[model samples]
Target chain A: MSKKELIVREEILGSNKKVAAEIRGKMEAAGVLVVNLLSSPGSGKTTLLERIVETLKPTHPLAVIEGDIETERDADRIRRKGVPAWQITTGGACHLEAKMVGKLLPEIPAETKFLFIENVGNLVCPAGYDLGENLRCVLLSAPEGDDKPKKYPKAFATADCLIITKSDLIPYLPFDLEKAGNEALDLNPRLRIFVTSALKGRGIAELARYFIESRVNMIQHQRHA
Target chain B: MHELSIVASLFEILEAKARENQATKIVRVRLKVGKLAGVVPEFLQTAFDSYKQDTIAAASHLEIEEVPLKVRCRKCTAEIEKEDFVLVCPSCGSTDLEILEGMELLLDKIDLEI
Candidate 1:
């Protein structure tokens, strides 16, 4: 009963990472900025996307890939805003995998300038997978309270930007904006934060401006490099 | 919920490694999971148990080693093992710290019978 030991140091998400890189390369080549939005359910991801599409569609050819456990509803909503939208239903998976996103890229409109992939509404599993986005944004609604950063540090830490969504509810809720923003900054010092209320259209313009400027900067940087 | 998918991916890795080594049966699979990796060990174990039935790792023991979150203080250069998701420096009480060890999910090694 002699047993031999094999040292195989490999990442479980290695295949996903490789496919994500390929998708990133494709998006970059096509001059499209991809953003992956992650959050818990009812965090107003679809609402925020609706606002973004309403504002950005006039200037940019926008597309959306909505990921849900089982729904074409989000995709249908985005399509109503006059933008191309696709839905990738995971069936039972908690988060969207890179391969799943990659398979739907060819279906996106050819002239899309901005591509938003609203990841499955999950704060935990979504952090473990990268969908080859130019930016990864995690949204925390004001009603969710300030302790979310402390509770789900991985999601806050991995995010490039943290959006405090539904900020208009602060008058009714006990959400401390400063505390939540500081806590997220502590986890990830480089995170760019925005307090937005999609329903009121507050901070929507600034967020859209940031996205446009960043995408332009990335393209120029890539060209010079 | 995602642990099941993680265990499925782990099984794929284990099968490939076992095939590479010409091992007929896997004895044990060792994984290194950091606290900040967002994986629950018990959930992963349960998922592994349910998913390993018809695979090469059917009789293998799943050994998971938990790694504590470690960070380095930028101000005091203090290395601290943190719990409860606190990101402050222990020595200087500064929030400006770099994470040294955490957020790791690695398939470390496998013990197999050839």
Candidate 2:
């Protein structure tokens, strides 16, 4: 009933961070390269994952944890591609937390060389939380305009790679691809941008190649360490 | 958008901390919200107020501290406050920059009454 200073010091995501670190350590020890993919609702994360699975099914053993607010349909879409994928329905939450990922890690096959976490379709909260991933990719669709990096700097700031989806529609959408890339690079100089279209199959091979190299590098680095 | 759910988490922490200190209620909950945290304080406050009833933080006042976005310019070696999405170095107009602050969302302190 009275005013008193409690001095309760704590991180806003203290609990989530703890669980994320554990998941990161576990994945690192197991030689798994975890990639957390974040993007807007229509940024084409699910379609891109399906394309990646199709392209790398023969080489990298890949699995996905699909995060959505309402349905398991995304996971089902990935599973239909003949790859191992699970869905984490966040209920009403806008983003996926580490605990949700930690719970699903067990269900994933141990032989998974690459683990992809398709984060809930959002640009804000997902960019703030680190889900124990070796790489964080932010997707921007051509239809979404090139000013996305300027509008959502946090998402671009946290991304290790930036994928511009639906490149095939670039001609019709009046998208400034160069400006988008420059904006993203301004936020993160090290971010690699990949322009691709799941429908046209453009850049899918390059994306697959990058993932393959990452898988090799991850294992090699762990082995030498 | 998700600040409503995050408010729930914040209350959970406040309640546990208040109970641990043998407090009857929490008075003030202090938070540090980063500029890039994507959490609108107005939205969080509304959500917190509605959700705090019947909880330990029923009568607690939310004190929000806003942290400005700071980025380190790799080209000019200067740190500047980032106001917009443009990650440019004000000193040198270079694109090489690193974020130093403005992404933090932490519970810095709290006030409780026993």
Number of the predicted model whose TM-score against the real structure is largest: 1
Error of 1 at B18 (Å): 1.4
lDDT per residue for candidate 2 within B53-98, as digits (tens), equals 9988888888899999988887778989877756778788887788
Report model 1's TM-score to 2 decimal places. 0.95
Quick one: best DockQ, which candidate?
1
Off by over 4 Å in 2: A1-4, A220-225, B74-76, B93-96
lDDT score for candidate 1 against the true structure: 0.91
On residues A123-165, what C-alpha lDDT tens digit does candidate 1 reach at each position? 9999999899999999999999998997888999988899989
Model 1: per-residue lDDT, tens digit, B17-73? 889888889989999999999999999999999999988889999999999999988
Kindly report which residue pairs in candidate 1 clash with one another. Answer: none
| Per-residue lDDT over A61-112 for candidate 2, one digit per residue giving the tens place of the 0 to 100 score | 8899999989889989988998988889988788998888988888878888
- Quote the lDDT for B71 in model 1: 91
Task: Provide TM-scores for the models.
Answer: 0.95, 0.93
